[model samples]
Target: MVSLTPVDIEGFTFLAISVELPKTTLLVVTSERGYIMCGALDVGLLNERLKDRKILAGRAVGVKTIDELLEAPLESVTHEALDAGITPGMLGKDALLLML
Candidate 1:
């Protein structure tokens, strides 16, 4: 299991997702709008998956923009996570560092 923390980005909200891999843990930073800015890649499958999906694929995967987040409900994030095959249970302790 991994943990994540919520962060604030220039007044926008962000969250960190910590995933357990075969050899190491990955920490990914995602905006409230669902944009994954950066993080660590420790899982081979995850690395491959990310590589297969072009960077910024989150936009097409259902992650919204700042404007979208302003109007979207919190459930939208959960829905996006589900669509991405990421479980809320899997994102418990990662800290969401704010980017201001």
Candidate 2:
């Protein structure tokens, strides 16, 4: 089953999804400021796969599951994300801001 909810974090509105099997929640955040998806088992793989896609969904973040993502002292961000000043140890909440 999948559950979706509108969530507000740090003044950002995000669409949150919960996947039953993986027990992970995917958040879709988009605005004039930026766009990105947060949640997954391997953030490194996530960025790699999307590296060439160049879709409107400009960013993909692997928080390594729901908890790890919400508490992102560790993350595998895309190169574009890197250019935005988001680092590995930066919290997911903070990264969300620069992802644009």
Winning model by TM-score:
2
Candidate lDDT scores, in order, read 0.37, 0.53
Model 1 misplaced stretches (Cα beyond 4 Å) = 37-100
lDDT of 1: 0.37
Pairs that collide in candidate 2 are: none
Error of 2 at 69 (Å): 2.4
- Clash count (model 1, backbone only): 9
Each candidate structure's TM-score, on Cα atoms with residue i matched to residue i, is: 0.33, 0.59
- Relative to the true structure, candidate 1 reaches a TM of 0.33
Candidate 1's residue-wise lDDT over 1-100, tens digit each? 7767665544555665566768655445564433432123223333355545432212112222333322222221223344555432232112122112
Please report, as a residue range, the 10-residue window in candidate 2 with the lowest summed lDDT. 53-62
